[model samples]
Target chain A: MIRWLLLLMLAAGPALAVGDPADQLPNPAQEERARVIGRELRCMVCQNQSIEDSDADLARDLRRIVREQVAQGKPDEAVLTFVHERYGDFVLLKPPFKMATALLWGMPAIALLGGALLIRGMRRRQRVAPGPQELTQAERDRLAQLSGRPRE
Target chain B: MSEAAPNPEAAAWRRRALLLAPLAAAGLGGAGFYAMLRGLGTGDYDPRGVPSALIGKAPPDFSLPPLEGTGLPGLSAADLRTGKPMLVNFFASWCVPCVIEHPQLMRLAREGVAIMGIAYKDKPVDSLGFLKQRGTPYARLGVDQPGRVAIDWGLYGVPETYLLDKGGIIRWRMAGPVTEEILAQQVTPLLRRYA
Candidate 1:
């Protein structure tokens, strides 16, 4: 049981150390706010990862900035706007809906609608397709003659 | 009784029309793929080329102390409004690209361009040593020990250089090392234009 407990603790080790950087503010509430904000801000160094999730030096700097802003009593929107103004729209993990990002945000839905239309068109075509017609006596006779066989 | 079958040509046309569904889908898919590739090629997909929001805006004011005992003057935002365009270079002793660009900075300094340096997130002693070894190319050198001033400048990383006009508005920013080709083609033209 002790060995199993030790293994569990070891498994949780990295998770505990993940976002607990030395730069975290001493105020727990402020730190929490910073974390919330940081989670929404992309790490400029690691584009796909949020600053809260990235361990890159740049990310740490960003996190510190966020914490400092929060500690200074800045509102969340103001803090976000500050970084956005400096880094452009790329620093936000969730890009705002705008003219430039319309295609990025709408492409999946557009593709889905296109796919649905295609499938519906295919199904409708299949439904409207004419069934195989029974061979007429004359066509049967012609086939028999061509094949050199006796007609039924 | 004789019966006629459907017209062969009309049926062929209908079949061809039915093929349009998949063809349109294939076209849409191809377009999406092409867009994704283009986005990856030129858009914010590459963060290095991400545009600085400070391009047209005046830089925030800052006053940083010179590196301890270097005898260099400290840099301030007010110094940039000297009625002549200048360059502000952010570098660190540890950054390899900064070493690569040091000689170019020296050449620019030699050409009478007033350049200010920020030793970003570096120790004062290391910065002093670096300037001593590589030769000083800056009119003023400031040490950003905790990097608060750097964050205020929205610096992405070390080895970033910004060209400010006489009014202290940032005109152009280069993110990485200053190669000779870049200096000639990009920097020199801008300097001449601003001059």
Candidate 2:
């Protein structure tokens, strides 16, 4: 039981370290909002991590910026636009649907439709396929003769 | 009895189409891979390269103080719009890549290219020492001790260089150290085109 408790604490450790206590907003609601926005914003320095989750200096700076904006009562979209203006679409984890990203956003749907069509086509082919036919009387008699048995 | 067959003409066309589908996909993938390899060789399509949003826009407003103990003037946003193409290099004293990139900057300076330097996240004393050792290639040097200006410029890391057109619009940004090959291949062509 002690070992399991130790393992659980180890797993919980990283989650506890996410946002620095000093970086949090005074109001819990505002802090929560800041975290929501931070999670959506990519840490440009870390490439694969959200600013809220990364320990990089730039990420920490971005987190502070987000909390500051939130504390200032700026709307979520306004705060996002502030960052988006500087970092471009790459900083948005969810790339906004645009002409440049149309193919990227459309690929999954296209693949799904293509796959459905392929399965449908295969099913249709299986249904139309020829089945075995019964042997004629003449063929049956020939088979019996070939086997060296008296014709029945 | 066998189920009715699909329309003969349609079936034949569909069969051939199905047969060609994998080949077509393979051909497209091969072409993409070939382009990617070629891009890799030319340093053109780095998966890590983040295209700057600052391109075609003015640099963010900033007025950084000159590095202490250095006699160079401080850099400001207004200074960049002096009706000539210039380079804005963000480097740090501790960044090894900056040392590698220094010779290229020196050569450009010798050829009369206007280059501005921002000492990002480094002590002014260290920056002064680094420049003194490197033979100072910048026309103006600024110290961004807290790196606030760097964040505004969307700097990813140290040793990033931005090429500004004559209008002060940023045309290109490189996130790594400049090399002789990069100078001859990318920088020279862009300088001529923008000039």
Candidate 3:
């Protein structure tokens, strides 16, 4: 009798184990946390969108990989590191500041400084009185015509 | 008539403002260009660093339609809790990478690795046509029109494959075309471990 019961339990094990979508879902808290993390990651396949936004197969695979890693008790940083190792910096929306990627980080500041200097230089140039040589005879004539005065 | 040239102070202020105008314009122009460069994704384009929400969590539950005449519906991560492990591949008819990885998928399928394909964000007819032309190695295929299903899976693009163990836990995943080296080194070993 016990053996028959054990056999019955074994037969029911898989049926019990098979879960519907609601049953198999991760905890809500965990899902929210994962969603936050996913939002920061770039989708390797889709150029502009975050992984959270993309529906590309590559994106889905990436999400599954992230979920598995998290479930395995890997830290968020470690999970990112694993992906980065495989896909290179291009897979990241935010590239770290490294020798290979330093330009990306530096460009904005460089541009701002350059812009300020150009503005300052233009201001200085604008302040400089028109050089005596600025007006050619043709310009003088045009000015005179416009002013209704004789050309000098 | 106005006395000589303007007062020295007025002339200096006028000169300063005039000089500053172009300089300010240049500065604005530079800033605009900088923004443009950043937005363009430039050579710095990288996606790996993008954080993932699914990381460190269980895969979402989802299903796909079966390939033609397989009778079985598409396999899901939930279904993977069965006896053997499985692989899920996201592909599209228009994707070059899908073509590149087609043979790899076929080999896995032939080895009884339980590989399934999701026809991601593609037209059904085109996906079917692609399978006809390239030979379907997928045990089944699910259509993901408009890519919402892929989004639910957190997909970035097509040609991504996920490995699930007998317990329905994801074991491995690949982002791009699965090179032979990758298959030999990473996927095959994982399968053996799970097997």
For lDDT, the strongest prediction is: 2
Model 2, span A1-152: residue lDDT tens: 99999999999978864867877888999999999999999998778989999988888888998898899999999999988988899999999999999999999999999999999998988876877869999999999999999988
Candidates 1 and 3: which is better by lDDT? 1
Give the count of colliding residue pairs in each prediction.
Answer: 0, 0, 41
Collision pairs in model 1 = none
* Candidate 1 CAPRI category: acceptable
**Model 1 over residues A1-152: C-alpha lDDT tens digits?**
99999999999866853765578899999999999999999887767889988877778878888898899999999999988888878898889999999999999999999999999997987766667779999999999999998768
In angstroms, the error of model 2 at B95 is 1.4
Cα lDDT, all candidates? 0.86, 0.90, 0.69
Query: How big is the positional error of residue A111 in model 3, measured in Å on the Cα after superposition?
Result: 21
Least lDDT summed over 10 consecutive residues: which range in candidate 3 chain A?
A16-25
Task: For candidate 2, give the DockQ.
Answer: 0.43
- Name the DockQ score for candidate 1: 0.35
Full ranking by lDDT? 2, 1, 3
Candidate 2 structure, TM-score to reference: 0.83
Candidate 2, residue A8: CA error in Å?
Answer: 16
Scored against the native two-chain complex, candidate 3 gets a DockQ of 0.08
